[model samples]
Every structure is written in structure tokens, then in C-alpha cells.
Target: MKRLLPLLAVFAPAPAFAHAFLKSAEPSVGAVVATPPAQLLLTYTEGLEVPFCTVTVAGPDGAQVQTAKPQPVPGHENELAVPMHITAPGKYVVTWHALSQDTHKTQGSFSFTVSP
Candidate 1:
């Protein structure tokens, strides 16, 4: 039994470390809304490098949406947001890349719909 226990210990999962994990989004990732949002918001699980974070928004037509640079909230390094110019009701794709204070890089994308 001791031998089995030692072997099992070697295969056990390692402890998790901090990373800039996408915890949630303002549009709620894959949500459909009745109106277009004037901005994009992303919350991470760890403090992020504001200068290294980036966000890109695109419409279903494949043209990029005019968005201001992403900025971390003043008191919340884990949150990022950008001003968006939403014109019409349609699908919008939001893509973001983040660099945590620990130097870990993470990225993801999702789409949401805007209906009148």
C-alpha cells in the first residue's frame, strides 16, 4: 500500500498558480442583447499588465469596430475596458489578449448579438 501511495503521489495534480484568467465579460460571452453596448468590459482572475493588454472588436461584416485602446480600471487592475462605436444591430466579436502581472499571457474571443 505504501508503494502504491508513493506512485500515486507522483501523478497527482500540481497546485494551481496565478494567471490572468478571463473570469467574466460585460456582454457575458455569447449573450444576445436588445441594444448594442457602448463599451466592452473584461474581468480577469489576476492583476494584469495594463500596457500589455489588448482588445479587438469586429462586426459580422469582418470590419473592425472603431475602439479605443483598452485601459485597466483605476482601482482594478484585473478589469479592462474599451470604448466602442456600435452603429447597427448585428453580431460583434470580441477578442482580447492579456498579460498578467506574473507575466503569464492569455487570450480568447467570443461573439454576441445586438437586436433592436
Candidate 2:
């Protein structure tokens, strides 16, 4: 019974490590489209604390196209939207970094193609 008590104590707080993950996106990744999207949206599995997220768009030639800042969606703690102004036709990569409510930082990238 003594050994079992120690094992139970160790497993008591095992649920605190649940990490956040990307849940969805607007103009979804790898999507090919004919027109430029007004904004880029990213949704997370969990709510962010500070909501300091950034999204950068790079054109096919590796040149940045959009410079607008990312804005957090009102009433939605796990979603963010960033304005876009894509001028060239090619592959564009959207990279994002966000801090979760637990003070853990997460980042990832996705790509989409703009038809010429």
C-alpha cells in the first residue's frame, strides 16, 4: 500500500500539460484560389492569455507582401485575424506565433497558392 500511494500522488496532476494546437484557418492551408483573401484567420484549440500573435505572409519569391498587424477576434479568445494584401501570384506562407493562457508559446506555418 505504501508503494501505491506514491504512484497515485505522481499521477494526481497529470492533466496540466495539455498543450494547445492549431484548430482551423481561413482560406485553409494548401488551398488554391483565384482572388486574394482580405484577411487570414487562425483558430487554436485553447484560449490564449495575452493574445500576442503575429502572422507574416511571404510571396512565391520569398518576398513579404502584407504588413498589417494581427488582430484578435472579439469574444473569441482562441482566434486571430490579420489583414492581407497579396499582390503577386505564387505560393504564400503564413507563419504564426502565439502564447497560450498557461504562458506556453506555440508557433507554426502554413502555405497557400494564389492562382495567376
Candidate 3:
């Protein structure tokens, strides 16, 4: 039994290192602004696969804005940028989903407001 215990420990599954998270943003979370930002930027903790990752923006009325597709920033695997065209807004939510190099997927969201 003692010899078998040692073998079992060796075969035990290790904990998975989860995909990266949103470390920060440009306008910042829950920020209120007088005018809309020309571009939105998101920074993550680890590199993300561009093909399987996406960032979306929704207006205060829960309607999605026709924003530009997310693009990877130069020399930074953990940063992404998206263009914006916000007309009228009260609260805007930014949602993101990303897949890591290990094929694990993760998602999260944040919101900010545009003052009238």
C-alpha cells in the first residue's frame, strides 16, 4: 500500500492556471465622462489569441454599438484596442471574451457612463 501511494501522488492532476483577466482599461472602470472616447483599450494579465478573442460595447439602452473589431496592440500580446462611435449614452458596458494559448476561454465585463 505504501508503494502504491507514492505512484498515485505522481499521477494526480495539477490545478489549471486560468486565462488572463482585465488588469486595467483606458477610461477606467465606472468612470463618468462628458464626451465619448475615440478609442477603447483593454489590458490583460497574459497573452490572448486574437482569432478567438472579442470585445463588445453596448449603449445605455442595452443596444450594441457598431464598433470596430478588436485588434492587438503592437508589441503587446496582452493589450487590445477597439474604435468607438457613441452618439447618446447614459451607461455603457464593455464585455470581453478571450482564449489563451492553452485553448482555455475566459470572459468578463465592465461599465462606464457618459454624462448628459
Model 3 TM: 0.79
Candidate 3, 23-89: lDDT as tens digits: 8997788999888888888888788887788889999788877377888899998888888888996
* Residue pairs in candidate 3 whose N, alpha carbon or C atoms collide under 3 angstroms: none
Q: Is candidate 1 or candidate 2 better by lDDT?
A: 1
In model 1, the runs with Cα more than 4 Å from the true position are: 1-15
Model 2, span 5-50: residue lDDT tens: 9889987876565555678888798999899888888888888753
Global lDDT of model 1: 0.87
Instruction: Give residue 2's lDDT in candidate 1 (0 to 100).
Output: 69
lDDT of each: 0.87, 0.81, 0.84
lDDT of 1 by residue, 38-110 (tens): 8888999999998899999898788878477897799988999888888888999988889999899999988
Shift of residue 34 alpha carbon in model 2, Å: 1.3
Best by lDDT: 1
- Residue 67 CA error for candidate 3 (Å)? 1.9
- What C-alpha RMSD separates each model from the true structure? 6.2, 4.5, 5.1
1 or 3, which is superior by lDDT? 1
